[model samples]
Target: MLRFFFSFLFVQIFLCQTSIAQTDWSKQLDHYISKRDEIDAVKKKTIKNLLKDLQSTREEKNRDKEFIALMQSVKAYEYFVYDSAFKYAQSANRLAYQLNDKSKIAESKSKLSLIMLLKGLYTSSIDTLNTVEYQYLSNEKRKEFYSTAYRAYYDLSGYSRDKHYSEAYKKLGHFYSQKLIDEFKEPSFEKLLGLALQSMVTGKLNQAEDYYIELLNQFNLNNHETAIVTSGLGFIYSDKGEVEKAKEYLMQASIADIKSSTKETTACRSLAEIFYKEVEIEKAYQYILLAKADADFYGSEQRKFEISYILPLIESARFRKENKQKKMFGLIGVLVLVFSLVILRQLQKLRQARKEIVRSNQNLIHVNEMLREASQIKEEYIGYYFNFSSQYIDKLEDFKKSISRQLITKSYDNIEQELKKYNSKKERQRLFEDFDRIFLKLFPDFVQRFNQLFDEKDRIRLKDELSLNTDLRIFALIRIGVNDSEKIAGILNLSVNTIYTYKTKIRNRSIYPNEEFDLKVMAIKSV
Candidate 1:
């Protein structure tokens, strides 16, 4: 009887352990199921933690590698909270690649690219995506990659102020837009859209509407699509200064029953902009309230803050308008009171409104002036800086030997001592400016040539500087036309490697497979 009890106890112990293991496995699977709900933030988090625990178990069992990748995706989705999500996603992506699980890898890559994009790391995003695009397996995946690349290019173009990059992004956007539209058995509709959007972005406003109308027709099939197309058209009309047409599309967009908070918020904002521009104050205010409601639903801090900043300004403008109207009404009661007193009061109030209007008009004028001044200043600086630099750089060799002789046994400290002899700040400033003008005129191509001498990264850093190192600037002058590196270096009071290093950095920054990207030629010549 005792031996029988012992056997039963052993069997019970073994069964309990097996049951616990099975329960844990089931719980992990449940976590993944919830995580698959892309919109559920809480589920995303729960899945992510569960995934970390599952990783060790997966390795121990030497099984379910795809499951491990799914967990990695769950963690990556939560990257909006922690920056490490990018790193974790990358690791999982590499593992997926090793496992030949291309699908999960693509998902991981897309997620990673988006994270980089949101963080404003456009260059890194582009670089990361370049590798991932090759792994795209489906048309959907290819469409996604192209879209991401297009957006990344747009962001990069904005930062660099490069029109070439902007055009490239526009082209890519059209490509992806076409891909998405074509996949729906509406090739003409998509083609129309491509032309419209491309034209709108490129400022060909006259041709955009027909496509917008066609896109709007799709709204019958998908009301949400209709809303988006109309809203886009409204904005385009707004850009063209056609306030009435803009309002029509904006109102249409606002009427859509959208589950997407972002879509609803955008439509509301569009409506508000139209109302504001049309001077429909009450309608504008109402639209803003509606926009706020949608913005709150979306949980986007950027949208909330943008609205917050605009709200007070909007309210103040409305208040002033209302009070000004009341003051106008007050003027009508002029005949009832004692004439002089009434006249005085009217004058005071009229004076106040006029003052307010004047102040507002003055502010507008000031803002316009500032804008004009800023534009003029920028154009003048770029034109003069580059043009003058080219001219000065041309004459670098004329004074290179003279400057080099003076500098052979000298130091920067000695130059500063000479600068100190100028007794007044004004004199010093004048002297510095004069020297700059002369030095730059002599080596006008110095900045470009100097930049040409750097690696790509260094060139980017240097191109941003309005002025460069004096000695290097001098060397750039010598290098502009003088091909001998050693002669140029000694003439500019620099070592041979200093000249060589400059040349090397410039080469690195240049378009690949080419060297001696002549700074003088590039700076002075236009393509």
Candidate 2:
């Protein structure tokens, strides 16, 4: 009975030990699964070459050895492609079974369980792991099995709505998580990856980010490992609401996944959703398209479902925005055209106003010239009138003195002769000569300018240079304001009828109107 009790205690301790070494399998797998598309081209080539070498080998032992190497190669693609990984793992399992190798069998089963878990078949993954007997597994194989089992239960707990089953799975997953930590005897890349993922699962984002940063900086990581670290950083920053930083890390992870030929990266899709929310439609379309292609290539139902929800929304928004911009531009073009026409109309009006201003200025200049000419004519006439009046007054005074002298001396006959000299025809002739000289002095070009108004045949010519013709005398008198026909006839010792006839002839010969002829004559001035 004591032996039975000790055996039971030992079994309990062994069971506890197994639980302690198990990890959060879902998160560990997800870290690499999100970068499944990112596979190194060179490594793929090398694996193909190894497979070619395996096919060419004739010996069974050589084929088995190559199969082991091929298994390692296919393990690289396990998280990337479920069916391909399953096939390779099955081949490796068969090869190990033929060799009676328990360690190799356990390793292949652990790998198969990981693929099953990635497909989200948690119960199937746990069942596959249970088929491997833990007591016979190598340390590494045992750790892998426990890791796969823990991830399966953790996922089950997360999806469970029932409180009792959820709590039970959670407690089981926690025990496996602690075991995964305790089992790592030394620091390693795998250990760091497990720690980072476990932190993320527990909502310890800060610790997760720190662990991922360390993995990136201190270690020479594989393409898959690099993608995992970068993607985790993106998730942490995204949760913290640092969108720009999150996008940067997510883009890096996405690129690495593509380069490494990873089959399942959600970083691109996450960025697409974020850009859509921010109204960056074009960016959303670009990222979502790449994600859609990836999901199509992956042939994964979950990825297809997630992308379906947001793709149409972003595309519709982009179309609406483009149409709105086109209409807005059309309106702006119409407004600009209308504004241009208005400006042209205003310019034309301004030019017309300027032309009118120029014409008005020209009219004002012509009026000013006419006023100046009139002012000059008045000044010349004023001097001439005063001199002529003074000479006439002196002649009258001399005549009066001569008549009185003749009366005092009793020379009636002499007085008569003297009076004739002073006031008769000869005296009138002298007075006319005096008037002509004064008028000619005042208006030297008067005859020539006046003749310019008439036809060549009608122009007046004087008989003597010192005397005026009847017609010349009439117009010359009019020029100096002796305008009345009677006054002009008396001054020139002619009849009013003759004077009227002469004035009529001059007016008829003039270029101007009959009424304006006299005025034009008066307007004439000295050269």
**Per-residue lDDT of candidate 2, residues 1-527 (tens digit):** 99999999999898566534222322333455455444445656766786675565525557567556657756766655655565667667767776777777777777777776776556657766767766677667666666666667777787677789887987777676667678767666656766776677678999989999999999998776787788889889989998767777777776667667776667778878877988978878887887888767655545665676677667666766765765565566568886655555555665576566556646655665665586577567667768878987998899889889889999999988986675477767776787777677678888888888898888878877677766787888777645446777888878999998987777887888874565567569753
Measured by TM-score, how close is model 2 to the native structure? Answer: 0.51
On lDDT, the candidate that comes out on top is 2
Cα RMSD to the true fold for all candidates = 23.1, 54.7
lDDT of each: 0.56, 0.71
After superposition, the stretches of candidate 2 with alpha carbons farther than 4 Å from their true spots are 1-44, 57-63, 134-143, 159-167, 329-527
* Cα error, candidate 1, residue 117 (Å): 5.4
Models 1 onward score TM values of: 0.43, 0.51
Q: lDDT at 113 for candidate 1?
A: 73
Worst 10 residues of 2 by lDDT: 20-29
